[model samples]
Structure formats: C-alpha cells, structure tokens
Target: MSLTAPARLGIQLQPQHATYGQIRDAVLRMEDLGVDVVFNWDHFFPLSGDRDGLHFEAWTMLGAWAEQTERVEFGTLVNCNSYRNADLQADMARTLDHISAKGGDTGRFIFGTGSGWFERDYDEYGYEFGTVGSRLDDLAEALPRVKARWAKLNPGPTREIPIMIGGQGEQKTLRLVAEHADIWHSFVRPDAIAHKLDVLARWGERVGRDVSEITVSNELSRGRLDDDHADALYDAGVRLFTLGISGPDYDDAPVQHWLAWRDRRNDAVGVDAA
Candidate 1:
C-alpha cells in the first residue's frame, strides 16, 4: 500500500542528564533543522540510572522552549495525568498554547498524556500508580473533563490544543486512543504496531469514532531501525514519527535523517498524487 503524506515529523529532546545551556542550544539547532515538533519527557528525575541525576521540570522548560524556538511545536511527549488535576492540566495547556502562539499562528502545543507507569515516580511524588487498568480508567475519565474545561476556559485553548495519548496496551490504552486521542503514540515495532492498529480500529468501531481521524505516532531510535521500516509504518497509518534523543547535546545526526525521511515521505505523496 502507498503511504499518505505525513502530517509532520517530530523528535523528543529528553532533558535528563543535560545542562540547561546545552538544551537551549539543541532546541535552537532543531528549529534550524526543520523538525515539526520538539518534545520533552515529563519527569522530575532521570528515568535511567542514578536516580538523583540532574533533570528539569517539563512545563517550565516548555515555557522556555516556547520563547527559544521559532518554528518547532513543543510539548511533553506524555504527561502523567495522575499527577495533576484535569482542570489544572487544561489551564496549563491553554496558557502554554498562547505562549507558543505568541506570534499568532494557531497554538502548536499537543497536550500529550497517559496513565503513568513508573513506580518510583508515583511513590516519590505521592501519586497513585495503582494497577495499569486503574490508571487507564482514570485517564479515560479525565479526558472528557479536560475538553469541557478547555471549552469553558477564557482563552479557550489557542486553537483547540490537540490531545495526544501515549501507550500500547491493546485492551485499554488502544481503546482510550480510539475514544480520546487526537494522536496515539506507541513504541512497538511495525508488526506489533499493525496488530495494535487493528485493535484500535475495533475499539473505534465500538465507540462510533473513525480510527483514521486519530494520528498514529511511535518512538524511533537514532538509526537503529531500518529505513524501510518507516514506509512500513506509514503504510500502516502512522503519519507522525518521533525520534528520541538525550541532551546536554542533542545530536543533530539522528534528526537530520528524520528530516530526510520526512522529505522522502512528502515526495512519495506528491508522486502518488500525480
């Protein structure tokens, strides 16, 4: 099957293990490189070893990224919905939406969220990281409330901040994706992704929503996956791809390949159109 033109390409600039100065430079470089979206993980500390390692808060850095970047859309890859009240999250998203849209383009913020998993994050932060089922349930409940709050908000979310839900749980997460997410993010391989897409479609059917309306996104490694893998994913209805990189120095090499692939995808779409 021929892939459709992707809506955009993105990269996650993880802020753990990096100095603020380095992060600032990398964000600037990514904008120059032509990435459509730039994301950072929402975490208090490094997800990897040395739990005490240096890290920056997600939203605070997002505010800074809004000022520092010129063209790249910025947001948390997936904020833990369990950590903040849904109303507060909606308000924060609205505020940042305006901040990112200061120059008068519809806001570039995607309110990415999920029922968080990390046990340490829950224990240390005093959030309930109960069973995965419970978390997903909470997320499903919170999402509509968020939308309602967004509508009631004074600024009314610069341009309807797109809601992105990240996870690969076939039963629950995929259903949430079908029901709530404007974009669904998964890290599974192509074959797994294909199967899950079927599951998501089924869920969409149950909920009376078109699965195609939800964007499929996945986390990519720096050249670790094959080039054709992108074509495979795009054919499977994943129009948005995200590569992950760590800072102090956000290496430009991986992002360059992503940009190249994005161009190729666009070119292919043009060919198909002709």
Candidate 2:
C-alpha cells in the first residue's frame, strides 16, 4: 500500500438543477479554493433530484473547463466507455489535453473512465444497455484502442493523460485496473478497501505489473469530512479524496471543510499539495 502517497482533494460538480453559468462559476470557485482536481460525471441525465432536470453533457463541458481553469486537472468522474468509439474518445481526450496546456505547461487532464452501468442513460441515449460483464468486455476492448490512437495522433497529448478507472468489482474491474489504470477509484468503504486492494494485487501479479504506485481514490459522498470517514480512507491508502456537490446553489461550506482537512492531512505528511 502506498500510505506515504500525498493526499489530494477533488470535487464532482454535478451538472444538474443549474445552468451552465452556475456550473462555470462553481468550477472557478473550486479552483480558487485550491482543490487539486475537478470532476463531472458523463450522463445525459441527472443521477439525482428530479429525473427530468436541466443537465449538461460531460465531455463538451470538459472542453470548456479545459480552457476555463489553468491549474486544476479536470475530467469526467468516470467516462462511459460504451457511448463513443474508443479511438474517438482518445482523440477528444488528447484535444482537451492540448487545450488545457497553457503557458508551456503540460495539460491538466485526467482520463477517468469506466464501463457504462446506467440503464436509463443507455436507454435514452440509444446505446446498448448490455449486461455488466458484456459492458466490462467492451471497456477491456476499447482501452487498448484508445491507447493506440493516442500514440498515432498528429500532435500527441501534452502529457500521457492519467487514466483513472472507477469500479470495485473484484474480478474484471480489478483486472482492468491492474492492466491499464494509473489511478484506481472506487466508492468502496474504508473497511472494504484492503480487501479490494488485495484482489487488485493478485490481478497485478497476474498482469506482471506492480500496482502499488497506482493512486487509490475514494469518494466522500457518503460521509462528511468532519467525520472519521475521511481519515479512515487515508489510513486505507487512499491518496485522492473527492466529494460530489450539486447545483442551484453549489455550496462552498463542504468544499471549505474538505480543503481544511486536505491541508491538515498533507501538512501532517509534509506533502506540498497543489
């Protein structure tokens, strides 16, 4: 476990119940608040609140965010691999990477991807809502193509955009994470993290890759930063902690709370967090 890894904070500004202007402001506010990464989910519809609500697309908004902020790395919390062609996805990611690269610095784009699971999204978006195993198979097939396309692009990505794979399935997901992911993100609880990492290690050994360097990430959506939950995640070897906030009024209180906790955690470890 990489317990010595530096702690970084992230937020998913849910694009529901708000206009693009509000979402744009929230992104700027989060960047100004010193969050390391800002994420938004890839879904055509809202995951919470009213089923029919004002929401925005993920990748296009990401392009805007790419040009909007200078320092904070941004991407989909986990892109649905089933929606677009793999090669096209890579091209889009590479473009965003270049767009975010300003003042001669590497782009701050993280390619966080996952196999699609939301049936409603698939049903409405005219995509196949296949079974979980089949969707995993599609992601397994797509990832290699995405990588290949990246290598073949005319002006390649500014940096090898970090791949963050989000899932907790002990079998296929762990294997995929061991094979390709730079960051393994999960909604798994602290107690379950060790068990999952154990599973991941076995997969790593199978794939002949050392998985210890892959940054472990977990979401704080289930508990407040003031609770022991965040610390428990830290103890479980999670270096990236993210909270999801929604719109209408994107509250900064939680972001402030998380920022304080992140500062304290990084300071305790003598890590100079961005």
Candidate 3:
C-alpha cells in the first residue's frame, strides 16, 4: 500500500426513509460542498430504522443522478450482482457513464458492485437466497461477462468505466478485486486495513496482477474520524474515505466536517483535494 493518491471524501446518501426529492437535494448539496464522489446503496428495504420504510431502487436513481449532477462522480456504494443480469448491468453502467459525461472528457460513474447479501431482499423479490459461497461464485462468473458486454456495446463507455468492488472477504472477494477492480472498498476499521491489504496483495500475486493501482477505500465513522484514525488509514494507504448518510432530512453537517478534514489531509500530503 502506498500513499500516492489524493485524499477524497465520498457520501453514500442512503435512499431509504426519504422521498426522492430529499435524496436529490442532498446529492446537489454534497456536490456543492465539494465532496469528491456521491453514492447510494442498492437495497429494497431500509437498512436501518424501519425495515419497511420508504426506499428507492439504486440504478434508476443513479440514472437521474447522472443527468442531474455535473461535477461529482456518483454510483452505488455496492450494487447487488444478483439483482440484474450481468450483461444488463454492464449496459446500464455504460449508458449511465455516457449520460454523466455530458460531452465532457470523462464520465462520472463508478461501477461499485458486490456479491449480493441481505436475504430479505432476495426472498421478497423472488430471487434465490443462496449460500454466501454460491453468491460469490455467481459474482466470479459474472464480472468477465460484464467486461465482454462493455466491449460489445454500440457506443462504448465514455472512458474506461472505473470498477469498484466492495467487501472484506479475503478469499473470493479479494481475489475478484485483484482480477477486476480499479477501486477496492471495505468497512474494516483503520487498524484492520493492513491485514486486508496484505491479503489483497497476496491475491494479486497469485493472479499475477499488480493491485497497487487499485485505490483503497474505507468508511468514515463520525465518532472516529479524528486525526489519529485518519492518519492511521492514510499511513496504511487509504485515499478515499466515505461516509454513509441516511435520509428523511439528509443532513449535510457531518459531510461538511469530513470535507474539511479531507482538504486538510490532502494539503498535508501535498495532493490537491480538488
């Protein structure tokens, strides 16, 4: 792990327990506040609070975000690979990539995805609630199909659409990250990042791939975003710090605080936050 990338702040504006209007406004506010990337989770039910609370689909909202936002890169924090066909997923990403480009030099979509979890989403939606190993097996089978579909699309992706893979499973997940990911995200604490990176490096070595190019990401815990924790993660080679914000009000205060921290860290590291 090397601290070569600029520090960046991302917000996962959870699209649960809030109306679409509130979610949209939050996205605009985050970009206005100079957040580097914006994200939404792919879930049918609220992950917190009320289980049956108001919730929205991830991909459709991302489509809207593509048309709505101008500067900030955006995507699902981790899309459920089981929810859609692999080729369709690739095409949807390609379409969003083009839409977000708005005739710019590059697109603003990051294709962050993972093996599906959450049994409720699968059972209620009539998808098979298979074992974790089975789900990961499915994901391993799907990613190459996604890339092949991207190659066959009518108008290819605006740029090489960055693939972001999330999760901390050292076996299958890290192996997939080594093979396919441009960015690797996990929720492990700062102290645990080194072990995960070591596992990821081993996977990279086994696959004959150099994963040093993959940007390291971790969640920003509000209580723990102090100088020590941030510094530890930075020293461990993490560059992207994401905060998950739930909705109804979609508070921006915490995001603002993290943005300030991001700028300070980037400046200290001699990398531009912009």
Candidate 4:
C-alpha cells in the first residue's frame, strides 16, 4: 500500500498466428534483452485478430520456456482454472519450477492464475460454460487444493512458487488475491489503481493477512509506454509493467523500450534490477 517496489518489465508473448519455432525464438530474444519476466496467456484459441487464428496452448509452451530460458521468470499471464484439475496444476507448476532452476537455486516460475473467462475457450474445448459466479466459485475452491497438493508433492517445490492472481474484482477476486497471491495483476486504468488497492487492503484486514508485500501489475498500453501513466501507477504501488506482443513476427522494439524505461525507473528509485 506504500507504493514501493523495484521496477520490473514483463512481456506476454501471445501464442497466436505463429509457429512454435518463432515463439521459442521470441522467448530467447526477450531474455537476452533483459526483460524481467516473460509470460504467455492460457487460452485454447486466439484472443485477438482472427478468432480462428493459429494459436498454441499456454502450459505446453511454458514447459518449453522452462528448459529454454535461464534468467527470466516465466508463466501464464493468467491460467484459466477451469481447464485443468487443481492438484495437477500444482504439480505442473512445481515440475516447471524445478526445470527452470539452475546452479542449485530454485527456478523462476510464477504460478499466475485466474478464474476462467473467455467463453469460446470453454465452449470449444468441451469444458462447461459456467456462469461467472460458478467459475469464480470453482477458482476459490481450487486454490486451497492447489496449495495442499504443492505441500504433498514427492520432492516438493524447489522453492515456494510465487502465486500471482490476475483480476480486479473488488469482491471475490481481490479477496482471493489477499488470501493467496504474492503478486496481483490487472489491466485497470491508472486512476483506478488506488481504489482497487484500497479494496485489496480491506480484504487483507478481513482475511488477517499482510498484503503489503503483494506486487502490483498492469499491462503496457497499445501505444508506447507513457511516462505520465507509468509514473502515476508507480506512485500508486505498481512494480511490474507487462507488454502484450503477438506473432508471426514477435516484435522486440516495444519490449526493449520498456526494459530501458524499467532500468531508468529502477535507477531513479534506487531499486536494484533483478
């Protein structure tokens, strides 16, 4: 709530209209370019452009990224909880965490997740298209199970996997975030951040947990990163800024610019870049 965190840049390399080879190349380029975190969306199909565009699944690509990139943390921007079993999700996250580990340290895997949205993904994949409340109810039920599974896994996680819950719903979503997340990601406008944070704080008090360490996150606008916008959010307690990039050709220019911005912000704030 004090609006203090090191500046970090994240890239959501959208897995649509591109070959697996191209996606892999983009991940390597992002890591080389010094982006703090790289993410892919959890959808069965494209979220933009052509509804039927060629698209890749999220978890599979993350598996490849775990083996492929060394320094950058990687995960779904928000994995849909409806598609996979809760315990299975926990195991997959732990396995990927181990896969990404290097030099005896734990791997960088953020278990980013949300209640299922995007009806088409559910309808086409043969998953039940439940109402919003039902889906959120499912997510609430799953989180505890996921944590329980993580505890009971054979070797356990390399480290405590960071849970990132993405959403801004003041009622259920923010409450869940207060209870479970280390990072809270949303696409709210700059002005809305304060109100959302206030809601989160209230939830934290009700839940009897300290939510101050939860890192705030938002998406980079479609245009170039705006200094005023970035400053306002940073002032309001956002550390991770994510840019969503799509393919056949995954452009690196925007990512590079934001990475530069991240560096400058970190320097200005005296926060060391990770």
Q: Give residue 20's error in model 3 in angstroms.
A: 0.7
Q: Who is ahead in TM-score, 1 or 3?
A: 3
Report the C-alpha lDDT of model 2 over 1-274, residue by residue, as the tens digit.
5777788999999999999999999999999999999999999998889979999999999999999999999999999999999999999999999999999999999999999888999998799897999999999999999999999999999998899999999889999999999999999989999999999999999999999989999998543554488889899999998899988798999889888888899899898776
Clashes of 1: 0
Give lDDT tens digits, candidate 4, residues 1-274.
4454688999999999999999999999999999989999999888889988899999988989999888999999999999999999999999999999988988899999999789988888899988988988999999999999999999999999999999888989999999999999998988898899899999999999999989999887876667788777777788898889999889888887888888898888788769
**Candidate 3 lDDT tens digits, 11-118:** 999999999999999999998999999999998999999999999999999999999999999999999999999999999999999889876558899999999889
Worst 10-residue lDDT window for candidate 3 reads 221-230
Q: Go through the candidates in order and give each one's C-alpha lDDT.
A: 0.82, 0.92, 0.90, 0.90
| Error at 253, model 2, angstroms | 0.3
Candidate 4, which ten residues in sequence have the lowest lDDT sum? 1-10
lDDT, candidate 1, 79-104, per-residue tens: 98888999899998998888888667
How many collisions per candidate? 0, 0, 0, 0
Candidate 4 residue runs with Cα over 4 Å from true position = none
Q: Which candidate tops lDDT?
A: 2
Model 1: weakest 10-residue lDDT segment is 1-10
Per-candidate TM-scores read 0.92, 0.98, 0.97, 0.97
Better of 3 and 4 by TM-score: 4
